[model samples]
Target: MQRSAAISLTCLISTAVLIKSSPPEVGFTLANSVQIMALSPGDPNSYSRPDLAVVTHTNLKLSVDFDAKILRGWATLYVKKCGITDELILDHKGLNISSILNDADDTALQYVLGEAVEYGEKLSIKLPQSESSNNTYKIRIHYETSPNASALQWLQPEQTAGGDYPFLFSQCQAIHARSMVPCQDTPSVKSTYSAEIKAPANLTVLMSALREEVIESDGATNTYKFNQPVPIPIYLLAIAVGKLESRQVGPRTHVWAEAEFIEQSAYEFAETETMLKTAEDICGPYVWGIYDLLILPPSFPFGGMENPCLTFVTPTVLAGDRSLAGVVAHEISHSWTGNLVTNANFEHFWLNEGFTMFVERKIDGRMFGDKFRDFSAIAGLNSLKEAIATIGENNQLTNLVPSLIGVNPDDAFSVVPYEKGHTFLYYIEHLLGGPQVFEPFLKSYLDKFKYKSIVTSTWKEYLYEYFHDKVEVLNTIDWETWLYKPGMPPAIPAYDNALIETCKHLTKQWLQWDENTSCPFNKSDITNLTSNQRIEFLDELLLADEILSQKKLETLNEKYDFDTIKNCEIRFRWLRLCLKGRWRAKVTPALTFVTELGRMKYVRPIFRDVYAWEEVRQQAIDTFLANKDKMMYVSAYTVAKDLHLDING
Candidate 1:
């Protein structure tokens, strides 16, 4: 039941298309698979992709009304079960399976559903009673689809960031695909799938998995039939349907984007072939075929998502010419780590994200040289730190071993998985000296565990069993200090002094939430920072803590006041920072800034989207005027409704 979930840096969690029925009537403790062991079957696969999935979807038809956000479909699935079992457990999260027909007759003897869990556009139904002991069974399912609830939604009529065409999109990494469809939505339940979607003919549909065929024309609607044979976890399944265009670079290499953004996506992804080829060279081969990209309608939220062959990237990558090669490299490397070998559960999500992130640096260095690669690492660390702080909890390096699937599933997953995972791998690589030594070990690990479920312990065991001489390398490094601790480790010479300074400054500003102060600025050294530096300071100030003091906040706002008419990024940052710094105070200065920002119409969506900005601003003002005596300080206890917005309050 997965629509499409990729491990993004902000949400570093693996996803599955699982079917839950009747709330734990039947739960799979662990899903195990067996592969022919040429040598260490328990070690890992030698980088060969799973090549045997024979489920075919045909005559696949779908109808979607964007306004309603609902999808209805009927399809014929031909399954040559091989040895998979008689009753095949297909993923069907969120969708109601109206009927199941075998051949041309209704042969579904009976179906057993475990617990039904709703998430995004997917729904998971655990079927404990579908006869599958037999070698094969012909089956078909009728279903309806809808928009994923977890998606970052926007008013439909709104234009893209560039103000061209209106569009909508979703991010499905971690375990949110249950909101999209229902099925055995776990990585261990790998299967082949095909899809045919009906969409507005004017719009283009981009998908992540493989596409053996497609049929399109300028009519009332278009039919996209994708024939995929690769055995992939449900999370990698994806589709992006909207008015768009594409350009082909080479055999199996293409770029997609809205007409208005065609040039940008093409330009930014120009080096895609090189990146894909480089990754294949290092990781063995491209199992899912060639690489393609989709530059979605604005509001993609994250940089990129590695969905099998198609990597979905935000339009923001088009900002600074074609300098987005780093992101492309990261997503492409996922073809090996995240896409090929995946994490078994959300808690071990770092297995997918961290490995991909680390391999990205290696690929970038090989393709774009060392300087660009180094920058990518620094950026990864910065972004990871920001994600950890948002949760307002300690980010211990050792905690990466805990399972996310059992711990509320919601709070258990985080950027720490990817960020910390990558950091750990980077440390491992550093300990191993260079790629010459590490590449074989990585290849050997993949060779052993491909198509199998893995966790931190599995990885540790493999490391010890294969490289016993270097096993002490793990002991030397303090994994606990990194994963279980609240802050980053001390500076290593691997990064430049500038990067270290950036981490220190950002970390200090972020930790300020625990260390409150009247004025959060480092007034002593504000003069020498660059424009980017100043913006970073302001961003952290707003995000780190709640606005509590009315008078002191107003005075601080005045102290950092800037010319109201300027278009400087700093001006935008100042308005946003002040509003966040004093929303609790609900003072005149904060209210005035909110009104001015609205009137100026120059606010970034990130700020304007602040939870109930309009309502909260007015409420603060009314509350202050009405109850100035008894309640002097604005309350930081945000009702649950307000948490939906960026602000926790």
Candidate 2:
């Protein structure tokens, strides 16, 4: 006779309260003899017990309800029972769960929604004893996302470029996926997923998967099907709904955006296919069949998110000259470094970002000589310096592997991982010969860890194993200081200074010039510099001991037309310089720039600079308050902390 398992609803609810009150070190046992740990060993931001039971595949049937600003859906999860556990624990933040049912028999199952915590809440479900010996079972959860889900950003028609239809997109990096769907919301768990999303007939829906087909529409809504065969962490799950159009840029790539941006986006990313091919030549193979780009609205926060098969980018990168296309290369590199071999948790984020940064520059070097690659590395070092100063020299967050036990991963985000991580790998490459020797190890590393999530220790073990002959050389380096110590790396790489010297010379000339001296610079001074070089010039000026005088700034702007530049990178640095120089006339323009687009790279610094100016501090706070609702959740949250505002408020 088959044994049945049933849990009392009241008892489960009381258990949830007890779990909430317990400390992080506590563990609770369920009625079905499974233990729910406070946090996963590899992922402190989640409450899922993947060691016991993990989701292997997910099938989502969600409908976009723009009126309600929510996603009503049912997620059917195929779970693999890893241990002798009869209960499954998932992560959820704010979801209205209606019912839980066994897929095979359609029998109601008992579950409990735990009290909320810093990351989210624990969702414990009792599993029925299996009659067969199979270790996998199907479980279905019926729920609706909260209107104010942190993973989702709902925009009105006015917020979009077309001003004709509303828009919706998701940013689930770190630990926000729990707000979208209940699952093993941690990078420690990788699962393939298929989705059937329904949206208004007038709008198009897209996901981080290959588009299969569109079912017949009923004039009001259309159902779109997508399948992602490559297993991915829940954080990479993405969706965008809007009035979008697409242009085929290459045999394997398409650029999607609103009608206003379609032509330019297609032109801007026309070399995407080339980048993909170059990446393949370096990183083995591009397992993701199709590579596409989605240009989100101005309010999109990051430079780009490397969702497998589809990349979500910001409009700020459309500089028209393709100078900013390096962001595209970075995302493509993630197709192998991040999307293929995953970081087990946010704590080891450098494994994802640092590896991608290293590969991105390699791709750049392959296209534009080694000097250009070294030039980019120098720029990245400057960014790392700025990040360290902002985060504090002694702060643990500056470490490559930060302790995020009680901290939100979002708060710990910075360039430390990207640059510092790259520095470590670059140092290793120098020690073990150059790219000639390191390139093979790169391929080997990806091949061994493909389709799996791993921690830093695992990666270190593999690295040492790969370079066994050089164990003596590796031991000579200090691992503890590099990985755990705060502040910048101990040593900087010998970057080629050929490209940066020109920018530095121009910066010095401007810095030494006096207000009384005849404006020594002319238009020809910067005419020969590339867009990236111009940005480097501006960055050097910002790091000076004193801000340039207002007169000098005006003269500089006059010669270079910095005030009217379209490239976001140059414009961001120029705006910060103006504010630092106390150029009152540019304050309004600076506010306009911060409000216009929500990319945190530009927004956070501009806002902080303005706030630093005591005269405009209140004004900056007011601007952020009025426009915070329009910013992405991560952007708003980080900017709030930057301004010292109460996050809850």
Candidate 3:
């Protein structure tokens, strides 16, 4: 679940330490004397009572209705009663439940739908007395999702690349899963799932699982069956149906996209196998069997969603040069950090994002070099600063483990967790020995907590236990400031500036250029720079004390031809610079970029910059109003907040 907006800002640092002997391989079992608690202390955002009874498995039978833009079907949940409770609780939003049947006997079950709250409505169903001797029970819920399900983004034919068939995709991370399924919508509870989805015969259907078989029910529709043997949080439960085609990219990988972008996607993600192998070398064996990629439409919000076997990626990454493929590495690393070892709740989100960022850079370093890894970390640090400034330095949301009670996790999403978490891990790596010492601990940690959800405290305790010999050095770290403090990190690691120095020098030259001085820059000045280096140079300019003048920007575009660049990352930074300088010519280009793709990372900031310019504020609002219906729920919701526009209107 890597956010595309923060992809460019990812950072990493590595070091080495001396050890007395080889670190012993730890087993999956925890010590009985440690008194481990439940997966979480009850997620505040969920209404489910996992403490009493929890769903262990979910079997879905749903039919897609593109005309009505809804999914009507039944979910049969296999539950395990943990306490002497007479009811089963689940989380649901905008779903109409028709009936609840006790699968043991063909009898109806009484249920209550609680009032809607900030998160969602609480669904409580009276449990039928079990006739079996075991504690497990099966309850079937027949329901239909609303046309406006926040988790689903229903696209018309015009919104898709092919413009021949409609598309449907789901984004259920954080808490939106409840809108689509009747289950405990929290990462603390994981369940194995199998789905039978019926959609138009012409459209292809895919989920976050291995495809068993597809049956042609009739000439009009087909039933796509998928089975996920691995138990995963409901958030990882994904489904997409559209005019899709697949091309075999690797032994266990396939790149799925529309006919228009299929070839480009296959080429862009050709290194997915290399990334998976590199991640395995750094972390551990890949638990999920297959690692396929689904190149989603431009309206896909995030950079990538690590949905178990199938990773959902934004079309913005098809930069033709494959320079942006590192995002796949981030999602691949999540196979262990996030999907394998889950975050107990959104408060401990850093455990998922920060660890993934650390591992992603490890893959980068292994694939490229240590210097490139450090350069990425430096870029991440700049992004962290920008995030803190955007979300006020003193705001508690900037904390690594901020209290998410009553706060929408969507609103709290930022680079703090991704970059700050990576910074903390890197700091610890430097303090202890380097990768030689810490990398072993990472594998051990994954082995200890794989397939389980945990909090920050559990991770910290394990960290202390792993490096018992370095407890004295660990004691020197200020846990309070690092975990709870809001602003910049307490200390920045000594990153190798050998690579970024060139970007800095170029940035300085551009900042110092003026009408009094002859144009000192040319296209050759940047010809040797990598795509990431050019991005770093642009990032530095954005953070400068004063925005570059329009004349200088014109010179930049003329010299570098940034206006014609196909790379989204470079285009994003260039547009922001132009908008900040109040270059009216780029305003239409910026608007087109925002409307064409719904990646929040690029859209939100550009919209904010446009809104800041009084002359275009109304124009920005109008453009958003016209396109809000096409944007993903999270993207539209957050962008509306940035524009101060009423979403209902």
Candidate 4:
């Protein structure tokens, strides 16, 4: 759970090295290692206390400086309470709190310094002897302090010349909001917020809730006013103010990014308006005001975060010239799915991710066409298959299901939520039909659940209500099987069909290696494929082909006389298939292909057998090197070792 703008990533790599003789033991049990140490065993709800929130007045006003990192100011809160002498507690991490006063200054309020408990510097306050209930009175507190690294931190980039970056930002989701502002930092407590943030003269300050007004600066500082009238979870509250560049998309939508990333951000996020309009066309009006995208600097982790008005994205999305529109669609869809109809706990994270992913698939399919739709669908299915593979034959990983799936929100971080959940929803959409068919149902769900917290069971129940007897297909499909009992979907004819179709048409053709069998006279069957088609084919064939059939594949391998110079992709594919099958006789030829391919500078970084390309590159390099000395591809040994050093170390 990253806090909004309150933390920095630090790598603690060490020089010490250790080699294991065998694979280490691991488990699938869901563990809350961090939370267990963070909270007291007897006081599980101590960190969450909404009962302490007492309203003296219906309205409150406050102002503070973000430069200090610590929120120090006085809040004049009017209250009415009815408990003779009990202290009230406010959500504050730490501070040098000086005075607590009332409107009359008649000393109606008293200050009883409460016991300060600091779990990574979160300071809790104690209210004085005053019946906070049913009393209309004024309360004020003066404060000053420094930034808490344990809670929040900031980066003042070097672009501001001699001055420090005036803009302030926050990483408030998941529990860090308390490090920035004083509040009942829990998902249940919703209150109106009016903040006056002071920043450098020209820099802008954007917030999580909504913008009320902005007061121009007198050449030194500016005062921005925000009125958050909606009841929102504390984690959803965010603040990102910086020297950003902004551009309008369609009518009211805007794209704001770091000054350095404006042009690319604009181009990559070009589809923002289209996506927004499509979402609105499906679900009623856009509930959140103008939608915006913020491209954070490179080090920012996570592909994107769905804040109310703003979506914070990692600059890494700028790769390969705007191919990241899928992520943009994902975030934008969150405006309705995750933000409007939120999940009460991380356990129901599927409600946020699964639904948002469903929206993204629809938007991508509509905007980019069937090719993208097909690619994305297959990609999702492939990822789910991989997840099952990692779990293994004993069903060890699958057995950890209910406990690991959503029990501890953090457990849902992997492709399990994004890919498996997506596949599940994709299956749902397959049955429900496309946009024209499911629009009404989607809109109805959003309309009914807006601003409310929900869980998976509630979602499932609501879905049943919407579908009713008209959709008996739901009865045959068990949603719980996908969530609790996991493994790859049962081996059915469809799975084999997909495997065969993907292998036959999508993969590169293999060469015949047999010295005895009659070979085909024509070469057009091999020459007809495009480079991309060839690579795609190679991937499927190598991944799916069984090891026992390597002898037959090898016979076909030799007929083509595989040569890296003329067919790098096919040669590499043959080499990879040989390695995967672990066919001892084919090692010589696989080695030959690897060596020749390694010399080519234009090959994909993965095929180069060096670099972080997780799949092909690493396996290719490791295989060739192991067989280098005795195989026909002996020259590949040195290249593999060198590449491995560069990549692994």
Candidate 5:
């Protein structure tokens, strides 16, 4: 044939190829089945309609533009056809969609975005194939997130510890993933992913996936690649770029942070290897390859976020004595509970947090002692009681399984799930004749749901199935109350009363001295108590039937020098007592403390507690306003809503 004839035939064949795709040769086959056990209400936090096409693998090729504070990327989703739906819908909020294309570059897939909703907008990609010839296809979306994308936090040069280069990080939990990329942004959908991120050569890029070798650059741009061998929910997706450094803590663990904090962060999380061993011994082998941590700046709101490989943590956990390593233990426990096995949706969030808290305590027990674990649990119980009282038991948010329909999952966030969920698990262990019988079952449960998501009902079904012999005993417990009833567990857990009562006795002695004006105790009495004991003591003191007098407040502070304590946990409780007693002299220290720390765990409540006093309410508001710009979105909003102040100004 002539050259012209050959070219014409080739063009005809290319056109045919663009119209449809051949089936995927190998992949997780669930993409072909319709609705393979996603949760009810199907992830209230996301706008994506996953029933149509379930994304299995995501390839993100992006440029991190620090100058513009944007991530411009081609999010190519490899989806498996599940039903007869006309279009594939993905979740996207505050993103600028530029174009969409099929595998063959010649064909641009027609797309339309719905009016932006709170969670995000729905991106609908029209399918070209009309028959079963194509079972899978790749949809490449070229888009850039807005400067104010809620998921990405952009910090100025001065805001970072380095004081040279700007910093950027992404937090996609509780539905914020939609703001970063268009995909099935629900926990109900899990998918493996690979990322190729380009940034300035001066900075480094890290993600939730394994840190593969970094490739060379064109001029000043550096390209980094990562591979997530295990499938993860969208919320576990993460990315960070900054003047970052890393040092190995354990064999498989590395602490990634700014240069100034690398050594201390490594020291703080040194025991991660032991925690990982304990967790695996309890719940199957650790599947996700390397468990490292990213110690974020002061503005990171949460103590730690369990984001698969690189768990994002706040620098505050660097308390020199390693007292705060519990946060690391908690995040590592998520490797088995929250990350490995996940909640089906935000409503059943306890499935993630509760189980993580439980495992965290167990690991703590193994590392320290059983008494150390009880000290933590007793503290957790006090928190649970306070949380229930604050939220009001009747409010559904206090329930283990909350009804999050039409509600922001963040609004419903509380300690109820973490504490109450752990209690429920503890109750189960006790009823099943303690740890020997229960620990093995825990491993089996995690193994059964590995790489999967489940609702509260699903967890219960597995519970009964796993303990076939003890099904009758499991049934004896008040299942409805634990699963559905709001506020507190069906019955309070019996914590190791020794230390808790000791703390209470110490407080009682101090309170009696205040009342009688002849207090027998002095600061020397508490000097010997451990930090955990001090925490419990302060907590119990604050729960006194009557407020302390100004003179008594002075006496307590002078004796213990609570104002000078180094631990933030103890310092926070001491400050709260001052606010409660309206101790005027101590107010300045509270304001100073609140301004410097942006962790919501401390900032929000301290703001609210101090704001309750009319004399210094404005001061609290002023302090918050002065530092609001420095706070994370999570911290800023929680304080604003709790105090009824609009922080945007």
Candidate 6:
């Protein structure tokens, strides 16, 4: 029942022959290998010239020198000429290049390292003229990553929990991969890779790939090898080395963290197998052979990076109640949505994030309930509206397909693509009658675009083509406003109000808590509600616009005591509300709380608000200056931008 590559070729060739008498078509055909002429336009943010030659695979051998704070490595890239001349350009940032050689002939190759730009320096390698379009060559470059490599965060032994050895990890998304490894540094180009990492024997190494038992350290150092059979985008490339260990939490899933955190890490992510199974039963089989979770240090930037096999997650998700496991579900959902089918460019990033959000909620719905899904969606809806307003409704970044040309991709990162994209898909499901009616289209969409990157145009085309005669339903969609217009979508998808109505009622009561003499909601009331309900209540209060009034904050905090909340999500928001409300007492604890965890989801917004408090501006500055080193590059870069501080090492 599966359509193999050969059948695909035959079908395309047959169609082409049939259309030959009519007109010249725009595509090509079948054989032992089908030539992919229509590669995704690729990321504009990258310095690499992928149009000239495409990288097929990469081999990385690096040694982590903790004392020197560097990763010295040589990268071997195998590239194929795309019916072009003999020159290849790669993206490199702050890398010390020693030499370049032709792997085919083992001879020196002439190269040029261009001036550094916003993304990186362009490394151009001259190669022998191509014998044909299929001509392939290997270029090996000897290099060492700069100490200030943005993607890599090197931590001293004292900086980590173990305090016995140094820690190093990579956050390569959004063009940072170029700083660590020279390549296209774009999500559009996926290359299967193998990594041989040498590190201190006292540490364990893990990457976004399969791993085997490491022989006990021989002496001062140990070597770890990883192989990713599936081709993955550069952004998905990741690695971590520290006093790490793992424990099997599911049939096909494992959790990795430092020895002290391993047990709790396993418990938090124990439902990964269930999530994977539910997702497969909903969409299709999970393609990635094994699913594993790795808990990075508190400052691991984002909530989770959905690296193909190994997902890098933040330590904040370990709330002891598993209330934050939704993040794990989100990452697992990416295995199907992002890893399998990627967005061709950051301009149309919603295809990756949006679909993942949709599938993630679907899996969560099955695991918990429809109420849970709608509740989460409602919270996300608030965030989307806030993001749009924050960016200014007229800003193009609020669009489903934002323009990334001549702009850094990182600046456009927001919840618009995520929530808006989900809204669009949910709208389509409604148009087609329901999810059941639209289920096949979802599966087929994944099947058609599996292991490939695509732009919005391709997605729209395939969607229309799938519906065939019934494509008329799509005609109802205002594609232009929904896809291009700033602000919000033309229409809002209907959410089950049943779940949020109670949460909304409680929020309203709290908003008037200062005016009311008696309140039905007490500390027991807080305990009675779900963790997500607590989040919803706090999120609603943030919109009261009367946050500057300390009277209300004192009354609320006195009764509920949000300062001691265990749920990180609720606790962070409450602390933020205190700052926004000018609750002077909150400034100290807020400073302390921000230092405790560096998860952007919790800390970035706190810094942004506290920085604006004016009263505690210097306090905020001093705290960030003190702890910025503890933050990940992505989070630190963002905070620095918010505070207009230079990126400090």
Q: Taking the candidates one at a time, how many backbone clashes does each contain?
A: 75, 0, 9, 42, 1, 0
Tens-digit lDDT string for candidate 2 (49-81): 777777878899999999899999899988766
Off-target runs (Cα >4 Å) in candidate 2 are: 1-37
Sort by lDDT, best first.
2, 3, 5, 6, 1, 4
Off by over 4 Å in 5: 1-40, 130-134, 515-519, 646-649
Q: Write the residue-wise lDDT of candidate 3 on 1-649 in tens digits.
A: 2211111111100000011111212342454112112112356567777767778778999999999999999999887666678998888898989999998787999999987755778899998875644567889999999999999999999999999899999999989999998888887776688999999999999999999999999899999999987778889999999999999999989999999999999999999999999988988898788999999989999999999999999999999999999999999999999998888778789999999999999999999999999999999999999989989999988999886655689999988999999999999999998999999999999998777777787799999999999999999999999998788889899999899999999999888777567887889999999999999999999998888888999999999999999999999999999998899999999999999999999999999999999998998999999999999999999999899877865
Looking at model 6, report the run of 10 residues with the lowest lDDT sum.
31-40
**Cα TM-score per model:** 0.67, 0.94, 0.93, 0.63, 0.91, 0.91
Q: For residues 118-147, could you state the per-residue lDDT of candidate 5 as single tens digits?
A: 566767898656443446777888999998
- What is the lDDT of every predicted structure here? 0.52, 0.87, 0.87, 0.52, 0.80, 0.78
- Arrange candidates by TM-score, descending: 2, 3, 6, 5, 1, 4
How well does model 4 score by local distance difference test?
A: 0.52
- For candidate 1, the 10 contiguous residues with the lowest summed lDDT are 630-639
CA shift of 494, model 3, Å? 0.7
Off by over 4 Å in 3: 1-41
Q: Which stretches of candidate 6 lie above 4 Å from their native place?
A: 1-42, 129-133, 212-218, 515-520
- Give candidate 1 regions above 4 Å deviation: 1-61, 75-93, 112-134, 147-170, 216-219, 249-252, 367-372, 395-398, 405-413, 451-453, 477-494, 498-649
RMSD of each candidate?
10.4, 5.9, 8.4, 12.7, 8.9, 6.6
Candidate achieving the largest TM-score: 2
Clashing pairs in 6: none
Which of the two candidates, 4 or 5, achieves a greater lDDT against the reference?
Answer: 5
